[model samples]
Target chain A: MTHHTASAEELEALARHARWLVLSTVADAGAGHIGGPLSQMDLLLALYFNHLRIDPSDPHRDDRDRFVLSKGHTAIGLYTVLALRGYFDPAELATFDHGDSRLQGHPDMRMLPGIDASTGSLGQGLSVAVGMALGARLQQRDFHTWVLLGDGEIEEGMVWEAAYAASRYGLDNVTAIVDRNGLQQYGWPAGASDRFDRRDPWAGKDVGAIFRGFGWDVIDIDGHDHAEIDRALETACGARGSAGRPTVILAETVKGKGVSFTEGTYRWHNGIATADQLAAARAELGQPETVGVAR
Target chain B: MIAQRQVWGETLVELGASDDRIVVVDGDLANSTKADLFAAAHPERFVEVGIAEQNMVGIAFGLSTLGYRPWLSTFGVFLTHRALDPIRMLVSQTGAAVRIAGAYSGLLNGRSGKTHQDVADLAIMRTMPGMTVLAPADEHEMRAAVRWAADHDGPLYLRIARDAVAPVFDIDTTWEDWAPRMLRDGGDITVVSTGVQTSRCVDAVRLLADRGIDARHIHVPMLKPLDEDRLAGLLGERVVTVEEHTMIGGLGGLVAEIVAARRSTQTVTRLGLADGWSESGPDAFLLDKYGLSASRIADRIVGVHSRPVGTPGV
Candidate 1:
């Protein structure tokens, strides 16, 4: 729960900072998918601050790792990470979705820095990441690619398509993390369909087995737990193409993790942050004590 | 009528031969999609993502970002509808300079029914910011469009009609610019045409000339980023827009907006599909039924010429 290693402390601070960034940016506008962003903050924080070898100042630097937020509707999470990591001045976060602001509802790679690909439509980001991984191998660039997917987005057939190809090519340099929040927009993922009686379809279907069939090393872990995410990423770092497998990190997380009203509820997938709601969210996230806001 | 898909495939092969970075990615329907030519010529650069249009588009975006000129081919219906998420996200969002070739465009796929016919592809694609749409009039124009797309920056969606259409222009004529080309010029009236209907417009021009009427023909290859300034300067006011697409949000609508904005003394007439589901028939039969063929367009020109000079309808 507490940080000891400098790298660990630095990463934890970045994750905490990303949390504050999302809270303040979206809160200022009085709207945003505060829940989804809050849920994925820790994962993005860990990737940018610890796992990925990227320079914020040199975002387009050749040989740098690529990260794509395929769940683009939750761009607040990515904006938070980008701003906190200094990809752009934190002041730019104030202009999120405003007229003339490059910070759109989804990732717009052309208009902003530190964006590998523009992704707002769900279930496409991972496939693009696969190509990035393939291109890296062809060019002999040794960089890894990471894709963040939403639990609801998994329902899209394209996710499986990319998964199959990634395994087919033995793309060990590529890693996919599912923000398994259990709830999508309409209802609980399990209740969305009458086909299954289980609470979690991901488990019964053997997600690992499916990936293994396509020759992928699948690992499931707690998304909020930094130590586990770090270890899994480290293991992926050692994989070789000859090994005939890619890597998947199935991260289990609450839909609105850290917030009381929105947590575990589908209604908050895209809930707005009102003035009172922002205060309540800040108190729950321990925002002020962790990272100071400029205002 | 030659299928534009053939031209797209052939031009891609030519691009592949000279440019190593020219790559083709197709959905599972490679044979029907007509990307097999590029596959056979450059096996290393061609990829087939089995039945996954979303993944196909996404991979193309990845390839484009890595300095490769990727040509993604798929059925128009699936490419525009099923892959909308990727098309909007990966292509529009990232601003990837990828070229997307959609075969079986419009109702060219006769027997496939509603699900397969992409009646609204142009309308949908044009709505996306920074997307360049090209519906080449015939094989000659199709080849030129593909060649231009390879060198052009930003995302491009190419709608290739399936029906076999006659070549409207000779390849040796040398059309180099990305802007709309003036096939035949006259001050009396400017007939704006796009895609499959350009061939009809050519025929209409000849018919009007026979009737002692001078009708100008302007063939637009690129739909988005409309060349309004040039169009307004040349057209002045007299314009009739024609297309084998819906009158709503198609070529007709685009030209009408420009002509209206400029308010040049010439009256505007539109000939396109009516606001409803199109009746099933052979491609030519459908064009004829919708008054999109040469005879139908010529009739529209005559009707416009008959109108009083002082009367310009809003």
Candidate 2:
């Protein structure tokens, strides 16, 4: 249950490896989300590798810290992190999104270990984390609950409802991490005459202020920075930022980070990467190329 | 006569005394849903989640994963309509052991009108995978159903009527098994009902006997995972279903599905809120207007009984 603190440099290396795994997994599956996973990879790597108090061998231990991916569409990122964390063999990830595979299109807690809750529908996992925090209080357990949400997914009213509950209950044991990637799949499409009309409607909203209004302690950090992610997570878990109030870390990030072509664009939000594109992405990440292997 | 919500609140308090793992989550209607009694008895275990039913359900799902038995109390309409997505994704899909106490079910919410009245909760809950749907006939059955729900370790939905209903079962009667209770025995035709309507059906069967109809009455407390074999065995050639819900998909739909799948020669006459919404009124007035009162139900059964085979009856 002790934190295996990794240096920022080691965490950055881990994030790069996880990003490669995420993109390769999605491209091999021929269908999966790319942008959100790439954007959220650093946050997941920082939490799973350095922060979360979980044992991969005993994933279902009662006192283990729980993590829920509220914006579950980017499950490939979480799956890659779990694989690298030794919860399962990294080789098993090849079956992701395949029929009868434990790695589903969305995270299925019942089907896979280390997955705390089954979540695909957005905006519900934070409430589940709040309940887990409450349960820990009622049971007198010290385990913490961490939930990752998407900036666009916050459009759901249920997310705010959970935000209010987490604050009203004084759930200091739970922390919410928002991937402020500044893009979504669909938005105001550009008309023929106006190319500037196309943009993410959820981008530029004051998400941290809204969470603060909900009585949460807001921490703004660069999501792709491992040191900032680690620091914010530590402050939140220590209940040092604002005692008796849940903390929400609005991690500013770019959609499709770490890839030159996909970064900051919504086109790669969810699509298959062609063979050449996958090779280019691997080459960019400094990974050796393999011939005739989709994965 | 006692309201089912009252029994639910009292039973929750009783359960909380023995099991500390029991928690109650309410959506700001604690007093109306009678969850206030449990909150008073066990303040720490009671979670007041404001007017957010969907969040209440999600919280209960999370608690269920942590080995806590959390019961969410709210109006049936909100639980089944507004919070159905969470109930489906978090509770039903994962088979979480979260109990949903859907109060103000049916057409009797103290004149709260159609918005508060829940006439289709049974149909919605019954169709959810791994969901145990129950509608007690009266206070006695409500007490038993609450206890059963606590002991059960899966997703469950308890439909509770807002108004006081006539008792159909004895005080000592318990839901020891999932079988439809036969309240009356006769030979001519079978009358099956669920929830509060079962009590009215009991009275209607008595009135039918007075008219020489010889009706048999059956009360099904458990709607989902229904005791189909037992119910199918007890059904006669002519079966009439009565409920406070819509005729399309409640008890009537269940009976029709069972009979048709059995391929038996039985004819099902479904009597309910005839394909429309009901206006807000007193429970008795609404029942009478919707052809669900004891006398009206008896009259409808008579029409069905006297009609010749292969012809539609009123």
Candidate 3:
């Protein structure tokens, strides 16, 4: 099946629309994460709209490329992207996090289409992605596997364990995108104690160097820039399965992007958005003031 | 007596010959777990994932999604204790068809001490949703269980012992309906057992017969999805459970729960280790120390049998 590759300009517009959907989805649920979803909005938009070779109608096709959201707390972002990409009806976004809803608090592959794996527990999706890459090689298929991880999620040792295995197996068909958003759920607040002086846990640590040390081809880029995201995805796909090395793209971003009050703040990492906050966010994204839920 | 792990390795190699989807993912204990035989036969499909058990399970889950039957071979403790989160999330929650062959199960791996031994694998694996837990009685049953798991479509956990023991069932014995098999039929008392300890229970039953105490022997291979109706029919007035695992949640706990749910007046005497760790020693010494030897098991049954009716045995 042929796929339409959206241009950089189109992807930018989609990202803006996705940001509004994410904030409104969380607002409708009264319980969801916002900061991480906004942080990884452009990255997911660029991949779903331009790179991933997937058919929304045939989500489980054998040869389709696989994508796993490692940082599954931000599933609202992925659900919005999947709905916009036509994997399911966009009106179903209102039922997210509700009882009997297919859109669970975390991604459940069994309950929803287009979810390659059920992932909520951090530090495990990369390993599953590595296995998918190996399966592609064993089955002699050309499909690629991509996994998105959070910066704080990297603190899990299992992530590094999967990193070593992907490198050891020479799985070039798999690519890892780390959302280096520089904020976790619990960051240092203003003027509490000297011990809590830093904003994030990895304030001064070099994430790209760490992935490079794990024998991956590291590509650093601005996560919110559609052009940079498009370029990094191109490079990652170009080196697929032939370079004999897995590639990791470290995309630097804010905790919450595209919103003046929420950007770069951990307070919005996971919380209910009041009507006032939702209206402000929608107004900033150039969306209509009707913010009960996204259509 | 042939080692169960050896039978597992040989059976895996045979399965790989006919099914190209059979892949072995070992966690650096291929030789100890006897997965090396499959590696030697199908080197291309063998994945040496080093000593990472969690990642090994995650990889198997990934492969299972793409129609590949991946078997994860590792020590039982690491599989149950260290990699439980991955198994719960990646395999059980999703119902992935990943085979987890847990080697060196039970207290029989005495040389490795309590740290390496796994005495509660059944308690853990059986409780997980959508997991098929099995513990074969001997080499013959191990072969059958391995072949069954190869064709079954779901998450499965096979508990393999470290040492070889006597076979309780014949080579042609097949698991029918995933039920508990009756090795001996008697009327005085019923003795239920699972895993490698069932063989000892068989010998203990013989000894009980010699002592004029007729004891029925029921061997359970499949712990989860147990044939509860069949097992309830086989239970007698007095029941005793024996296993190499802990006393709390192994065969003993299972039998006790079944008996309690029925509200039957029959007494259940649980025989296994207490709520603590055992020292490193030979299999015989450890089994004897834990009241699991054939003679010791026979003695314990005799004590429970001699008790008056409606009186529980501690």
Candidate 4:
């Protein structure tokens, strides 16, 4: 699980591709989830390009590590990574949200390649990942299953059900990362609730402690910090083999991290970028007129 | 005579041995539903979720997520009524492959009263997206359906009767594959029946033949994705649909959609339970009162065909 460094040129190019992919897809369709996709773009780029053991051309490679984007509304990041990894032609990204397109609003395993599970209804993906991990263990395959979850999605009761089951089974091969960006659809997690309240809802909840209480090896890290992310993943790999204990990484992230206007705003979670907004965002991301190797 | 309810439990136990991934879940009625065999053999896999049918469904969804093929058994009344939403969201929306066995269905809960006898399970499950409905004709077909479901990866809802009706199918016959089978043949009228009600329809056909009435009976085990083409071919100009389930969303409703679209000169007579809760009594008494007996069915067919040579009677 050592971090294999992608050249600076490759990193920049992948980041650029992921950023433009989400922006262009949103622009092509009349709407899309903006903030979550923008925030998770770097994590997806790093995984697909540098770490994930997968062959884009051979999407169904048996030994490939499986990845599920449980928070499927932010599919732009994952889809772009799949395209760059060669799962499909990059040109198909433009057709996102169009009629009869494989790249729909959410990930569909039947339609798209390299997607382990088709997910949109939150709190179910983690359970499926646990299944995949169990399948691997039963067959003695060395592949791991990773699931990306959104912070707001934790509100679903089924998430806790899966968490409890995963710990009970001691599914070490499965790892879950919650993009701990406080805002949800309506407003902040606290503002959107009457039943529950918290200051920094993500931190105050003690998601790590809950996992530990359920017998999981918990790791908390800054999602944007690549070095820390790499270290946590490596530790998770080592922890996976030691007896029975799964790992849950609580990744603290900023919604719309790079963009100034949309950053940390609940309204921007599913912001429809105006023509002006699109142009400004594209300029800030350093997207060129013609797409090439993303120099 | 073997009940459809018993076959479901027996087949699940047999399949569980071969397929270790298969798990049986019961909502505190393992003995009633006959899933105790599975519980004894595969203790690790068998989960008794108490009497919480709603929570049982949610847990089944959770198990299906972990690569376990969970077959949940419960009374039709509770399984369909109490857990409809979770089953719809988890199995239909997320595309989990969970099998739900609804026993004691459609007036089969003898002496269990209105609250226990379920005539709505078929209507409820038939309306779900990505849900495959299997209403086996007899114990043989019911066992086969359970075995087939274990190998198949998708959501399934099966309705079973509690009464020990005589078997309509041969013990050697393989109807468990979900493929519709042709039971009897004739050119005059086609009779499509499902579940335990199919045996009564067969008996009705025998009675009709005594009075020189010719009819074809096509037994459909799979309800959803209703064999539209197979049904169209068999149902000529005169057809009758029968079920122990309510006529609204049962086999009658399914056949009506296909027949209406084709605009075939065929007239369909639907024989099923009338829409109402029933009083507590033996299932035999309930069947007689509801006009679900073979004698009543034969009389109805005789009355319809006697109308006119070319036209069908309403």
Candidate 5:
């Protein structure tokens, strides 16, 4: 009930702040999954800052929409968004991944509020969300289950397994948004180089069609475009009540978005920024030059 | 006694009838895993998660968070290995209330070849942090353990056997006691065994009685959350541990650790399959080859009873 609707301009600002915070926290902690989180920040902002029906005052309400960061290595970004959303003090983002910090490399539901399921290992988060959506059906609750997964994680067979089960159950209440930057832990997978001259690295294949084949309501859109992201969110939320098919928002994102050197690259996916790299990223995000150096 | 898997399926149906939160998930092995009994009773609550064990575990973990007690069943081999990480993270790490009935475990899947046989399940389940591992001796204990598991506060793995077993204890036996149940009392040697091996030890007692030697047979139900005092009490002059598992981290390894730490003077002899795969055959032949038959167990206990005190046998 206390949600503030973010306009396109405000949503862009939120995305900027999220990207700045993600780079800052990873830079401070000396390590994190920077590329994927940067890729998914705008998608997260559209949901958390505007669309997601959650209560910061009462985080565990049964009827609230559930958001699971299945691409859980992106805790730096989600932790920042959660803090900005008032789940906790914003300053705690500095202590992420440090010794004795509640913000571990992966998200742990037991360690923090506003977290529905703890995840880090790829491919299982969607299944958790499927279970939640099915639970909402069985328990007669009117809440939504939104999961954010990574593109590389789709390689895991378990993701397809979850895809089949979600489709079988007709989980209209579940919406899975994939941060499809197209590169995994290592760079583009081996066969991609020979496939399409390495251009449109999903090998010129469509991720939306993949989900469509699995019987999901597919929405292919630019993840960084606030308007497209909002439209997909509205379309997904409109099918909320029951008997609706599950939706997969194929958000075409750039890995390491917002920072010039790291954008669309794999080098900064799992690492700490160097002094120069950190300064470059800050300047790109137009963040103030502060003394929070990478330790 | 009935088959542990049968008892598991029946108890699931009975539990599902009474508890609205009880939901059963099967991994395309409903007939083998015996979750079909629950399906018949409460089809709405029974979910066939196809052949995907990994997704089945994740789905169960999801349901547990929503105030529902999710019961999962699949072959021990696939459930423990195929979805091990998901079970560890979704269920074990968070201590979720996901009661997993690991069916067709141990060398009991004699005709199904090496792939179906899972002697390492006890070790794998035991190694997980905060996972409650239970391998009951008989159907009575299996039913008791299943009932206890339905209400057990956290993640639990109940190992079920493929074959039937004779009743080792009363119907009202307390499966959650975490202590070994003493079957026969004797002072010469303490023979601790679990799962179907416990019954073979009972058969071994008759052979020992004929040789003027006495044997104390103890049937342990809960492999993890072991009762330290009961284990210490059962560790007599000579200790013999037998299990339908490998000597790695099953009953034998667990008992040996306790004996070594608490009673250093006690000699511990372990009887189980050697570090190798079991070939396809009748369960009896495999048991005999592995030195788990009644005669082998009888001879083992006699050897331990006659050996000098604190003299360990390989």
Candidate 6:
């Protein structure tokens, strides 16, 4: 299979497009995640556009590298990226959170095409990815499985359990990317406020050290940087099975990257966007000044 | 006669010998759950998920998608309560083919006290949409249920007791069908039971026969897809349900729901543990205390039948 490495500039453009779509989609839907999706769009763009071995025409292709969005509330981001990747029509982003739309509040694999696993309840995707990686070994397929998790989502004990098992079985074909955005459902980010005693809302835990302690090959990268995201993912993909441990890329990200008003705050996790705020976000992303643009 | 979980472990060896796809995942209670037998026999296919029941279920659900027939075993309480959310989302929602052995259930685990005693296993399992809930009466039925679950796709929860039971049906009999099996027939009253409670019903039936009560006996191994039609046919306006579970949700609750929906007029009497926590005691002492023993079951049936107004005599 031939693969092309999208230039950092191209991937950055895609990420901006995804970010623009995330803002407009959530604003249109009136109920969708904003902060985590915005922070993680670059990584999503890097993996989906530049990396994931998937065909939009035949989304269920057997040899495709699988992806699981463990932090499922951010389906708006994944759905937009999947659309941009040609899994569905780019126009469908406008239908997000609509009563009849397949783009549910959580990522449902059964309802949507190209979704490897249905995950909404936190800290479960890594275990499923472990199984996918194990499946690769059992079936003798050389495909890798990637899972995107939130730093706060790691607070779940099941995450640790999966981390332990993945290492115990030496599932190197699995890669976990933690969107270390420093804010969770609670908005007070590490340095955003001192209410949490100078610690991130995710309990001041070391994301890189945690994965390394769980016997994974850990990588720290600037999540908003497409070049760094591309390099880290490529390194993890190349080191699969040869690394002797599951790889976890802890990408440090702002709570909201593109939009200054929503950036690095907990409120935007599911914060409703006013009309003016939505227009400001559009101006930031350089989209046409149209309210809910058709397509 | 043998312990149902003992038979479950042995059957895992039998199935594991023939089927390479069969894998057993345990939650550190393999010996108590009898999954250690599978672990020892086929270490390559067995997984010990430490003391984490939640991870055991998640790992097992993941393994199922990879063409593996996974049987996750632990005490009924943990599998039903500790990992229920995942079991619902991952296994039930996805409709994965995973066999769940909820072992050390009912009064059998009385020595472990209330925390381990599984009275609500059936009520919880029966509520799941795609869950095929089964509670075998004896070792033969347990073997057949395990085999059936292996072939039957989707999620299956097999609830089993820890104690060895007296065999009601021979192993040679066709133990495949899930419909409630009629062990004895009469028009006076129907006595439906499951697990070791079925053995108690058998003894009670013998005692009732001597008293000319002519009670019909039915063994309900399959609790969820219950044989409501057949049970209504033999119930004859009066039915007595026996189970070593909580009176709220186990066999008693299932029967009440089936009878209420199918035969609303039929008078159903339920006997099980009270709605209070139970302390540690001898297995026999606890059974009689809760009126689940053979003699008590017979006495309750006689007392109910002899009463002229047809009111329940607890």
TM-score: which candidate is best? 3
Task: DockQ for candidate 4, please give it.
Answer: 0.11
TM-score-superior candidate, 1 or 2: 2
For candidate 2, the share of real interface contacts preserved is 0.84
lDDT of 4 by residue, B1-314 (tens): 77777777777777877787887777779888888878887787776656666556656765575578888878878878876766766677666888888888887686888888778787888889888988887887777777777777889888888877778877866653455667899877778888888889999999998999888888888888666787688776787888887878788888887888987777887888777767788766877888788988888778777766556423
User: TM-score, each model?
Assistant: 0.86, 0.97, 0.97, 0.80, 0.95, 0.94
Q: Pick the candidate with the highest lDDT.
A: 3
Residue A256 lDDT (model 1): 68
Between candidates 1 and 5, the lDDT winner = 5
The TM-score-based order of candidates, best leading, equals 3, 2, 5, 6, 1, 4
Q: State the lDDT of candidate 6 residue by residue for A220-260, as single tens digits.
A: 99998877887899999998768888999989888778988
Question: Compared with the true structure, what per-residue lDDT tens digits does model 5 show for residues A130-166?
Answer: 8888888888788888999887788788999999999
* TM-score for predicted model 3 compared with the true structure: 0.97
Weakest 10 consecutive residues, lDDT, candidate 2 chain A?
A: A190-199
Instruction: Give me the displacement of residue B105 in model 6, in angstroms.
Output: 1.3
Candidate 5 runs further than 4 Å off? A188-201, A289-295
Model 3: how many Å of interface RMSD? 0.5
> Where is model 4 more than 4 Å wrong at Cα?
A1-3, A7-13, A49-51, A187-217, A291-295, B12-36, B39-132, B147-157, B175-191, B203-218, B224-230, B236-238, B275-314
- lDDT tens digits, residues A1-295, model 2? 6476678888777777778888888878888999999999999988888889988999999989999999999999999989888889888878989789999999999999899999999899999999999999888899889999998798899999999999998889999999988777876664443222346545445677778899999999999877788889989999932499999999988889998888877888998887888878888887666522255
Per-residue error for A156 in candidate 2, Å, reads 0.4
> Chain B alone, model 2: TM-score?
0.98
Q: In candidate 5 chain B, where is summed lDDT lowest over 10 consecutive residues?
A: B171-180
Clashes of each: 5, 0, 0, 1, 1, 2
Question: For model 3 chain A, where is the 10-residue window of minimal lDDT?
Answer: A189-198
* Residue-wise C-alpha lDDT for candidate 3, range B101-183, written one tens digit per residue: 98999898748889998989988998899999998999999999998888899999999987999998789867666789888
List the pairs of residues colliding in candidate 6: A187-A266, A190-A200
Candidate 4 lDDT, A1-295, residue by residue in tens: 2246575467766776577667767767777888889777767766776667787777777777778898989987788878877788888887888889999798877678777777787766776676566556655778877888888888776567567666766788888888887667764455443322322445446777877897888788888877777777777766665648789988887777776677777777785676687678778778776752221
Taking the candidates in order, what DockQ does each have? 0.68, 0.87, 0.86, 0.11, 0.80, 0.59
